[model samples]
Target: MAAETDRPAPEALISAFEPDRLLKQDQSGRRIAILGTIHGKQGILTAERAAFATESPEVLKAFHAAITQVTNLGDNDIYRWYLASSGGTNNVTAAAAAQQPPDLKLNLIWPCTESHIKKYSEQVVRMVTETPEIYHDHVRPYMSAKREEGRLNWVFNILEGRTEQEDVILRDEGHRGGAGVAGEYHYDDAFLMLPDLNWDRKTMGSLHLLALVQRRDIWSLRDLKKKHVPWLKYLRQRLLEGTVKMYPELEKDQLKLYVHYQPTYYHFHIHVVNVMLEAGATQATGKAFGLENIISQLETISGDEEAGMADVSLTYFLGEASELWTNVYGPLKRGEKPQAG
Candidate 1:
């Protein structure tokens, strides 16, 4: 048996089989290997230089001399040497490569600086007060016709005084064979009128006309596009240049115009102006083929008044057109359907 003092320590006993210690020694060897690799790289560089000297002695001599001269110079002196060398004879040409600009990600930060609530409140007030006359004069007549035709559920009027007696009867089932009640209407003063700014009336009217045409089963989308876009484009150009020229007063007012194809309604119409208006001003206005010169043009094209059934008065056309336009372009009220009436 070995003496207690001569016995190997516990750590020494573990060290013989310790994988961790072995791993540490392996890591140390790896570090030495890395250092040796660096040494080898330096050696490779020297060999490469020697090979270059053998292949191109004059170039190698020039490059070596330049490097030696640069190494001896001070930092500032070295910079000046490099600058001079860049412009000097036998210059080492660096190809001019296109430089890409640094990417600057600009996130637009929109701040709610104005009081929208106040602005909207004022708009509502103006719309409620000023829109009635225009609606009554321009939109109500056609809506009244559609209502009489039993093709519209209700025609709202803000222009006329709201009263229970003024309620336009949209459907009369009591009539024999459902004969339409045309031109029978009234107005009420008690009913609350919706603010015009709350809705886009021109878009509403265009959509309304679209829905009406769709329900009537007249005109395909392609036909509407073919017949309408070109005509509207021409009309729009004419109105901007000719009509506006005729009525130069319109130039003072701000104007925005748009034309869109509504598949469901299958008709083309024009939206003009903004929904909101200043005090004593009008809300958004739209002109439909049914309301504009396109009606007469259609009549001429069809060569029959009945074939071009759009020869109604602007007021008459607008009411029905408004409903269709509203259906397509305006926001709907509760329980409103896009279908006719």
Candidate 2:
């Protein structure tokens, strides 16, 4: 309704929300979608309610008072809790449960339009086979252009401590426990570990984390060279060890570390997730490449320091609506050179 700087406080807007209807709810019951409006807003609000972060104070306090039903999703330590009123009500009536709102996961989009809703809706995905030639000739240029457009400002914001600093679990500023010589690693080689937005942070089985390097030169895994093998190995070990230290309930063996071929951002980052987490499209074989495998590949590659991931082919899937598909692969599929945006 207003410029971001002039927008009302989230608490004020939330208090004034009026739900028009329930739009959808995922089968896991962890997410619920709704169409609604703020008390004074002119346009609809597309909002979603998800499970609260497990470590949140509200969840800790409410866990004892409002839990009416605790249904085990499976033996994998996933459980869904149905909350009743905050008064510690013993009456387990369906109507009472229905009247109570969900716990504290609210993501709101105010003044939302039909186009906004359509953009977020599901889309078709197709598998893409990318040869080294195609990557060097077309995709690399597309990636460079996209990066020049400042798409990674948010990532830089976090890395520079301009925002989301509280969410960082660990920050390693280029020193490998003082083991290496000075200048062996560049100053920008610093990396940090933080929770992924998708994680609830409390579920051991659903743990998701990210390790992002600060250097701007390496755009993705492709930029990794044999010379960077030691750095990669250090990153993998630190990510695993740091996570285990931060979350004692988890062990090194319980974690799965990988890197995405076509990362959402053009930054070299590793995805650290729990082994018990469901293997969704994100973890699918075509999309995720194991860190160990990459290490082994680099160790055995023929060339000197310059030999790297770019020397090989990579196959992955792209959403039909993605710019890569629209501007690159789609054109190539028609027997044409990939077009630039």
* Clash count, one per candidate: 25, 0
Question: Candidate 2, overall lDDT?
Answer: 0.75
Q: How close is each model in CA RMSD to the real structure?
A: 32.2, 17.0
Badly placed stretches (over 4 Å) of model 1 are: 1-223, 249-253, 258-271, 274-341
Residue-level lDDT tens digits of model 1 in 1-341: 55988876765643343121211112111111111113123211111111234357887577556431121111111011111121123433333211221111111212322322232233311111113343334333434443354322222211132322222111111212222222232211111212112222222211110111112223222123223333333334433443234334445134444332221122222334321222122222332222234433453554332333232222211222334434421332334443432
What TM-score, over all chains together, does every model reach? 0.19, 0.67
Give all candidates' CA lDDT scores.
0.27, 0.75
lDDT of 2 by residue, 214-258 (tens): 988999998989988878878888899899999999999999999
